[model samples]
Target: MAQLSWAAPSAQALLAASDAVRNPDQSFGLINNLIEYRDGKQIDSSTLAVYARADRKTGQFRNLIRFVAPQRDAGKLLLKNGNDLWFFDPSSKASVRITPQQRLLGQAANGDVMTVNLAGDYDASIGAEEEIQDGERQKRASYRLDLTAKNNEVTYHRIEYWLDRNNSRPIKAKFYSNSDRLLKTAYYRHFQTSLGQERPTETVIIDGLDPKWITVMRLSDWAYREVPESWFQRDYLPRFNPEQAQ
Candidate 1:
């Protein structure tokens, strides 16, 4: 039998191509328009801005965020330095340093229920193409995907992801706990290009167990600029950055 010279692109290849196509609109990355969370009987909403970079060698990430809400005068800042996490809330005028266990809880609250479900980690073979609504209008190609964490001990065991096929930006996601119970669902809305890449302008997280527990976040005025590395240090939260509060 003669070997076929051409085969359909691997799922990874197809996904990479999709990402490349959308990269121009998403080059500078994303600014979320909204993020909402509800836990039990409590509901909270915030406006958020996120920046992420993945380190190849360590397979880890540097994720940073500044979050604000109407009830508070100043927002909170969170930095995830690999496994360690640091947080500062201006309203309380306090900084909370998290241990690894606390970091896990924080990650869960932030919708990073599983390591694989974290944004910016891409795998092509897991999803199928579909059509989805873009913002309040416009229909676009999207990929509905299923992903499992490489490690099994995590709280969330499985995740269903919806990615904009044109840009490789995830539009929605559903997370499930180890017992196969629904934990939460996130919706990404209002995508726009900042710094040349397609990114979500808003994100909403709804707690499945408690409808009252919800969080809303919005991102605005996203700019690609260099921030000092020292900003991520726990020691820098209250002492080194007094000027930020002012």
Candidate 2:
């Protein structure tokens, strides 16, 4: 992966740069507040305490997402480690395998809540250079990154990612399915200092089928913590307690 210092930037390097801007390179935790909307009205909401740490071998993140809000949904966990995704319910003491494409919030998928290094999952190429409107409604010169999934396990089969040309900050992205249909349009906004660099603090997702159906994910309380690799194992779910364990 090439850094911004490269005069002749490679597609892979530029894509990696945008990924770095979105995800921290080390173990981190944050609070995600999700609000679902329907036709401009609030419908449902949830809060998640997310912990992510990079795997030593691949340097990809392994995430532990715990629901911490709305008494009814508390104590539920979603683990995304390597290629496996599992949902564990503390009340039932059951763990079930899940796909990343499963819907979590209104327009947000299970994969959206977890940390993923896109450069590791997709093959990228620069498609075009254009000035696009950002989440804040400001026009920005960006590089259109065309991404194709390296395998079937990824969230989307195709993605048209737009990143700021100057600093590689992700501006927005259009996701497409394998059948070449639009899935969702996501806008990364509200950049704030977290764990060091400025990262998107809010993500606004619009449903491809119904534009009125929206999901807004706001991130906060970001901190670097010592996340153990053992927490990612399937057998550890029943015993894993986010409050006392890690």
Candidate 3:
């Protein structure tokens, strides 16, 4: 049998660049705050605590998110297993299937908060070399990338991504649907050294058609965590307890 590869040689280059810009470890924890704005007015906000573990060899990721703010939503849990994600409501005590593209708090998607490795979810290819403005409005050479989803589970069906030529860190990305309709644009900025690696700690998203609709995601509390293997199992979600795990 021939060995199967996820991306072509050209695509692999783009994937390498993406991997360099994100979490490169098997397990980690972070706190994410999602804020939404419309017409320059703040609309909504939410905070979540997330724990994620990835199988580096297989590129399989497992994530667990617990809502930490807005007392009403506190204690709600979301668990990701391979391509399937489930949401658990503490009050209802039910686990319902959910999609990554579904809005989480505002413009942030469930996948955005969970932070999956894009290299594993999409096949990427270098598109064009363009001079683009960075988050700071400084001009820089960037690699424009075309990313196609390998499976249906990804948050977006396609993405036009950009990376800095010098650092290989993600600069900006445009997410699209299967039909190629642009949905949103994201700017990765506020790079800082965290968990021993330099990575973007904030992402600003704007609606494709409505520039006034904006969302900002701020990531903090970066730490290496040892997630229990059993926490990744769907059967264990109902009884999972963060307090006892600590």
Note the Cα lDDT for every prediction shown: 0.53, 0.91, 0.82
**Candidate 2 collision pairs:** none
lDDT digits (tens) for residues 1-246 of candidate 3: 123244423655766666756775768888988899999999889989888888766776689888888788988899998888999987877899999989886677888787677888888877777779877778877778788899887899999888876778889999998889998999989989988789899999999889899999999988888988888777787788869444
Models 1 onward score TM values of 0.64, 0.95, 0.92
Off by over 4 Å in 2: 1-8
**Better model by TM-score: candidate 1 vs candidate 3:** 3
lDDT of 1 at 216: 56
Q: Return the lDDT, model 1, position 148.
A: 65
- Evaluated against the true structure, the overall lDDT of model 2 is 0.91
RMSD of each: 6.4, 3.2, 5.2
User: Which candidate has the top score in TM-score?
Assistant: 2
Q: Arrange candidates by TM-score, descending.
A: 2, 3, 1
lDDT of 3 at 153: 77
Which ten contiguous residues of candidate 3 have the minimum total lDDT? 1-10
